[model samples]
Target: MHERIDEQITFRRLEVLLAFMEGGSLAKAAEMLDTSTVSVHRALHALEEGVRCKLFLHQGRQLIPTDAARTLAATAREVLSTLSSGIRTTREVAGYASSVLRLGSLYSLTLETVPAMIGELKAREMGLEVDLTLGSNTELLDRLSNGTLDAALLAVSELGAEFQTIELFEDEIFFAAPTGSKYAQHKTIDLQACSHEPFVSLHEGFATYHGFQRAFHLAGTTPTVAMTVGDVFSLTSLVSGGVGYTLLPGRIRGFLKDRVHFIPLDSRFQMKQQIGLTFLSIRERDPALLKLGVICRAMAKRFGIRT
Candidate 1:
C-alpha cells in the first residue's frame, strides 16, 4: 500500500480528488479547479487505484462519492493543511521566509554584470542570500513566470506583459571580425560589405540573434551563416580563430580586443540590445526585490546606462 501510494499518489491528484468530492461531478470539479473534466476524471481514477478502493459510483452522468470517499476527503483536508503548515514552518526555520532571493540572468551577463550586481547587493543587504541561475533569455523568462526566480536580468524586449521591468542599460551591437581582416581597418563598416562573409551566430532564442536579424534586415540583405553556437563567448572565439565573422555587443570588445576587431555598423544598420531587470508585477512590493531594484538602478547610472 505504501509503495502504491508513493508511485501513484501526488499532491495535485489529491487536490483534484478533494475538488471532485466537493463539486460532486467531474465537470463541476473541473470548473472549480480550472482544469479539464478529463483531467479530473483521470486524477480520480488514479486516486482510487492508489488507495485500492472504489471511492465513487458512476450513476448515469453523475459521480456520487461512497462512504470511503467522504472519509478519505476529510483525511485529505487535514493532511493538506498540516503539509502547508509544515512547509511554512520549514521555510521560516531555514531563514528563507523573506531573506532568500533567487535571481536569474542570461549567460552573457555572467562575466561582469552579474558579479557586480551580486557584490552591490551583498554590500547593501548583508543577510540576503542570492541564488543565481544563468540560462538563455527564454529559459530565464520561463523560470521567472513560474516563480522559480524572484527576478531576472534579461533583454528588455523579451520581457512579457506579466513582468514589470526596469531598464538597466543598452548594449550596442557591433560587427566582429578577425583582427587581420580587411573589414577590421574601418571604424564602421557597411552590412552589405560583409554579406558574402561566413558568419557565426548564436541560436535563435538568444537576444543577440535577434539583433543580428535586425542588422541584416536594415541592410536589406541576408548573411551567409556558416555556423551557430550557444553562447557569446564561443561565438567570439570562433570569430577570433577566423572561422567567421559575427555580431556581438560592444561590451565584450574589451575581453576580445586582441583576438578580434569590433567594428561599429553603419548608422543605418546599427542596433542596440536593451538589458534590464524584470520581475513579476505582483511582487512589486517584495522588500528584497525592491532593494534589488534600487541597486540595479544605481548600477545602471554608474555604468552610464539610461535609468
Candidate 2:
C-alpha cells in the first residue's frame, strides 16, 4: 500500500502536471516537454490519481484546470526550482563549476612544472583561481579520492578506474650526490657498486621513494639509508650538506643546481617516472578542467608527451 502511494507521487508526474497547467493544453504540454500528446495526457491522469484529487474538468477534449491543480502547480514549480539550486550547490562543493580549482601535486613539481602550469592557467583570462596542495603522490591521490582535491599531478602508474589521466612526460631517476663527490666523476653510476654508500631518501608513499627502492632491488642490493625525510626539498638539502646520497628525478636538478651533482644510472639499475595530470573520471567534462587540459597539453609539447 505504501509502495503504491510512493509510486504515484513522483517528480516526473509532478512535472507533467505543471507542464499541462502552464501550457493549458495536451498539445502545448507535449510540445513543451518534447513528448507525444498521449504521453502528456497520460501523465496528467496519473498525477491526478496519485494526488487522489480531481485536477481537471473534461469538456469535449478540453481540460479545464481545477482550483486544487492551480495550488499544486505553484508548489511543483517551487519544488523543482529548489532542487535545481541544490544540484548546483552540490556540484560547487565537489569542485565542479566553481570559481576555484582545487589542484594537488607532488612537492618536487614546485620547482618548475607546477609554477609554469599555474602561470599559463592564469594568463589565459579564464577567471578561474587555483588552490594548490603539494605532497607525496600517495597523499595527493588520497586527497583526490576523498573529494578534497579536484585533480593532481603525480607519477603515472596503475591507477583505479575512477581516475582519468593525461601523461605529460617521463623523467629518469638519477644518482644525486654532493658537489665534487667521486660518484659525479662517472658517466653512469652503478648502484650495485654503491650498496655500502650511505643514502638519504624520501619516506614511503613518495614517487621518488618507490623509484629509489626499485633501482636498488634491480641492482640486487639494498641501500644503507641513513635517514628518510618527508619532502624533496629536505631530501635535497640533506644530500647537499653531504649527509647522504639519494636518487632524484631529473626535473629537480635545477633546484639543486651547483649544490648537488646528478649522475645517470647504469642501464641495469635505471628507472623512469612518468609524470601526468589526473582527475576524477566523472569530472572529465567540467569546464574548468577542460581549460586546464588545454593548458597542460600545450606544456606537454616541451617534454614530447606521448599521445
Candidate 3:
C-alpha cells in the first residue's frame, strides 16, 4: 500500500528499502541492519509514503522489489561505497599509503631483530618496503602510541595499560669488556667483586640499564658508572675503546670486533629482558597490522625468541 509522493525520505528508511530489496526478505534485512523485523517493516511502510510509490509488491508472504525499488537500491549502494572509500582513504594515509611499514625499535634490537624482521617481511612479501627508525624503548613506544609509528619492536615488556604487546624475543645481558681488560680473563666472573670497576652503561631508564639495575641488586652491589650513554652501540664504543666496562645484551655480539670480549654472566638475576612488538590495541583496524604481526613473530623465532 503506497501513498503520497512529495514527503522526504529518511536515510535509514531508504537504506532499509534498499536492504530489503537486495536481501529479498524483511527478516534478513533486519538481521543485517541489527534491528527487529517489525522495525524493518515499519520503516518500509514509511518509505512507501516518502517515495509515493509501491517499492515492494508482496506475494502471499514474500516481498519482492518493484522496478523503481531496484533503481533506488543502486543509488543506496553508491552512497555506502562512497562512505567506505572515504574512511579507507584516511586510514591509508596514516598507514597504507606507502607499502612500507613505518617501524621503530629499541637501540639494542637494531643489531639483530630489526634487520631480521625486515628481511623476513621482504621474503614473505616480495618487494615489501620498510621505513625503520632506532631509538630507546621510551622514544619508540612514545612514537608508536602517537601514531607517528605504525608499530615497534621494543625491549620494554612492562608498560602500563597504554600499550598492547606480543612477545618477539628475550635478549640476555652479558658482562663485557675490552679484550685485555682484567675481568675479561675470568672463566666465571662475580659482578659484586668488580663493583669498583669503572663502567659504561645505558642511561638509567633504558631497558638494558633496568636489567643492569636488577642484576646488580641481586648481586647486592652497584658498579661505579664512569660514563652514562644512551645506546648499546655507544656503550660498546665507550667499552671497546677502554672507556669503561658495561653489561651488554648478547645482540652486541654481532657488532663485536677484536677490540672487545664478551663473557657470559653467572648471576642470580639471569640478566635477561624480553622484547616484543607494541602498538595501539586497535591494530586490528588495519588488516596490514595482522600481516606485520605475523612477519614480526616469524623473524623473532629465527632470532631464537623464547616466547
Candidate 4:
C-alpha cells in the first residue's frame, strides 16, 4: 500500500494536468498555457508517474485521459478555486485595497439612517462599495468587536473602551399604540396605567428592548407582553394591527406615524437611547470611517436629531 504520495506531485503538475484535460491535445494544451508541447508532455508524464497510475492512453498522436485523470482534473480546479478565495480573504484581512466597507446597524436604521449614510459615502468615495448588515444592537456590537464589521451604527451604551464612538443623536423611547386607540388622546403615557394592556415587544438584545425593560421598571409595573418579535418593523406592525402596544425609539416615529400613535413617555419613565457610529479604536483615523462620521453628523443635523 502507498502510505505516502510522491513528492513529484505539485501544484504546477496539477495545473498542467488540468490544462491538458480541458484542451484534449498536447498541442492545444501547450497553446492554452503559453508553453511548448514538449513541456506539456513532460509535465503530464511526470504527473502520471508521481501518482503511480495510467492517466492517459497513448494511441499514436491522440492521447485519451482515463477516468482517474478526469477526476484529478476536477479536484485540481476546486483546489485552485478555494485557494483563490483564501488569497482574496487574506488580502481583505490585511486591509489591502479595502474599498468595500462592512457596516452593521440595527434593523430599524435601514428605513432612513443606513440608506442616507450609504448614499453620502458613495458620493464622497469613487468606486466604494458598502456592505450593510442589519441585526440587533448586541449582534452589531459583537460583529464590530470581532472585526467582522468595520463599523456599526448602534446604541453606544454597551460599547467597550476598545471601540471609539461618535455620538450622532439621542432618541427617546415612546409609547406606541395603534392609531385611534384609546391611548391616542394622551400627550404622554405612564407605563403603570397600561400595565394590564397587552403589548408586543422586540426580542432581547435590541436597543429598544432595554429601553422597554427600563421604562417598565421605572414605572414599577411589568407589562403584559403578548408576543416578542425579532425586528422593530414587525413589532410596530403588530401594534398597528391592534395586536398589542410597544415602546419604541422616536427615530422610528416617521416610519409608522400613519399606522401607529407615538406618545412620549412621562418624564419619570423616559429611557433615552444614544445612537452613534462605533469603530475599533485602532481604526479611528481610517479615511472611510472618518468620512462616515462626517456623514452621520450631517444626517443628525439634517434630521434635527443633534443632541
Candidate 5:
C-alpha cells in the first residue's frame, strides 16, 4: 500500500480528497468541484486503496469520512497553503513580482558615491526600488557574473570581454598619511620617499591593493606593509591613528578629511583608478540599467571626471 501511494499520490489526488472530506459525500463533493460524481468516487476509492485503509464508510447514498481521512485532510490543507506561499516568495526573489534594481558596488563607495547615485536614481524614477549590495571588488564582480547583480559601480583597470561598461571617472591615487605627517606637507611626494615607512593596506583582492602594487613597482621600491585589512574604512582609520601610511584614491579624502591628509603622487609613480558602471553585455537592453548608466555618466561629468 505504501508503494502504491508513492507511485500514485499526487497534488490533484490530495485536492480531490480534501474536497470530499469537506463536502462529506461523493455527489456533494462533485457538485462543489463541478466534476462528475463518478470522478469524485473514483478518486476517493484510489486514495483509500493506495493507503490500504478505509477512508470512508457508505450508508445508503451518504459517504462519511473516517478518523484517518480527517487527519490526512488537515495535513493536506497545511501543505498546500505552505506551497502557495513558497511560490509567491520565490517569484519575488527572482524579480518577477517587484520593480527592484539590484545594484552592486565596492564598500569604499558607500561613504559618498553610492549614496549620491542612489539619490539620483530615486529622483529620476518614481516608484523604482533599489537593492544595494556593498562588497569587495572581487565579490561584486563575482555577483555580477552570476546574475545576482543587475549592475555594478566599480574600479575597472582591465575590462572583461563579456562586460558592457560606461566610463564614469578616473580618480588619481594619493599618498594618505596622518595629518601633519611629513608626506602630508608635500604638495606631491615621490613614492620612494615613503618606501621605508610602515604601510597599512587592503587585502590582495581589492582594486586599491593592485594600485598600491603598481605605485611601488613604478617607484622602484617596495613598501614595508605593517598590517593588512579588509575594507577601505578600516584602512583609513588605521592611517589616521598613525598605524602606517597607505595609497588610496582621492575620492575618499572627504571621509577622513580632518584626521588624514592626501598628497598627490609624483608623475613617475602616479596611478589612477578607472571607476565605471558595468553590467553583462547581454543585459544592454535592460531599461532600468540604461537609465542608471545615463545618471552615472552625468554625475561623473558634473564632478569634472572625464567621461
Candidate 6:
C-alpha cells in the first residue's frame, strides 16, 4: 500500500499537478495559474516528494504522467472536485456576499456605476452579507493584495501578472454642463475647444484625474480646472449648479439626469476610462467569487457598461 503524503501535499500543490497535466507544460500551466514556470516546477517537485514517487516523466520536451501519476491524477481530480464542491456549497449555505466584496474604482464611477451595481446585487442576492469600501484604484489595490477584498472593480492603465481581469466597460468622459450653458444643445462639442472653459475635475491622486490630465496634454491644451473635487456625483452636481463645465462618464446620468446635461466630446481623440473587475487568480476556487464575476459581467452588459 502507498504511504500517505506528509503535510497532506497541500491542495495548492495538487492543483499545480492538475493544471500541468491539462496544459502539458510547466510554462502553460504557469500562464493559466498566473505564476512563474519555476514556481510550478518547484511545487510539482515538492508534491512528488511528498508522494515518494515519480508522478511524471519528461518525454521529448513534453511532460507525460507515469502509471502511478495517472492513478493519482485521477484521484487528485476527484479529491479536489469533492473538496471544492463542499467548500462552494458551504459558502452558499453561509450566505451570498457572505463576506465583503472589496470594490474600488475611478472617482468617475462613484455616482452611477458603483451605486447601481451594489443596489442591483442587494436586490438579487437577498439576505446576503456584504461589506463595501469605496476608494480609488490605488487604495483598493492595497486592500486587495492585503486580502481585505475578494474582488474589486477598478480603473487600470494596464493589467498585471498577479490577478485575473474581466473587462467591464469603457466610460467615455462626456463633456457636461447645465441646460442653459453655451454647448447645451450642441450635437457634440470638440474637446479641444473647451480648453478655455473653467472646468470641474477630480483631484490629483485619483486615476481619473491623472487620466484626464494625460488626455488634455495629448490634446495639446491645458484645462482651467476651476474646482478639484473628490467624487463623480459632486462633479456632476457642481456642473448642474453652473459652477463650471466638466467631463464625466455618460452613465453618471443614472442619478442626476434631471439636473445635468451630457454631450459627447466629439474631439478628434476622446479620452475613455476602462472599468473592470479584478481578483487574485488563486481565489478562483471560491465559487462565490466566480459567481459574482459572472453576475458583474452580465450586469455590465445589461447596463451597456460593457464594451
Candidate 4 regions off by >4 Å?
1-91, 94-97, 300-307
TM-score of 6: 0.63
Instruction: Estimate, for each residue in 1-307, the C-alpha lDDT of model 5 and write its tens digit.
Output: 3433454566777889888877777777899889999999888788787777888888888888889999889988998888889977875675433578888988877877888888997887645588998877788889988889888889985666888888777888999999988777898988876798899999988899999998899888989999999989999999999999999898888887999999888888887888888888877866677777788889989877766
Better of 4 and 5 by lDDT: 4
**Which candidate has the top score in TM-score?**
2
Model 6: residue 190 alpha-carbon error in angstroms: 2.2
Per-residue lDDT of 218 in model 6:
73
Q: lDDT scores for all predictions? A: 0.85, 0.90, 0.78, 0.85, 0.84, 0.76
TM-score of every candidate: 0.68, 0.88, 0.79, 0.67, 0.67, 0.63
Task: Sort all candidates by lDDT, best to worst.
Answer: 2, 1, 4, 5, 3, 6
**Cα misplacement distance, residue 111 of candidate 3 (Å):** 2.6
Kindly report which residue pairs in candidate 3 clash with one another.
none
Of 5 and 6, the candidate ranking higher by lDDT: 5
lDDT of 3 at 57: 83
Of the pair 3 and 5, which is ahead by TM-score?
3
Tens digits of per-residue lDDT for model 4, 176-205: 989999999999998888899998999998
- How do the residues 48-107 of candidate 3 rate in per-residue lDDT, one tens digit apiece? 777778887879988778888888778777887787799788888778544777888887
Please identify which of the two predictions, 2 or 6, would achieve the higher TM-score against the true structure.
2
Best by lDDT: 2
lDDT for 207 (candidate 4): 85
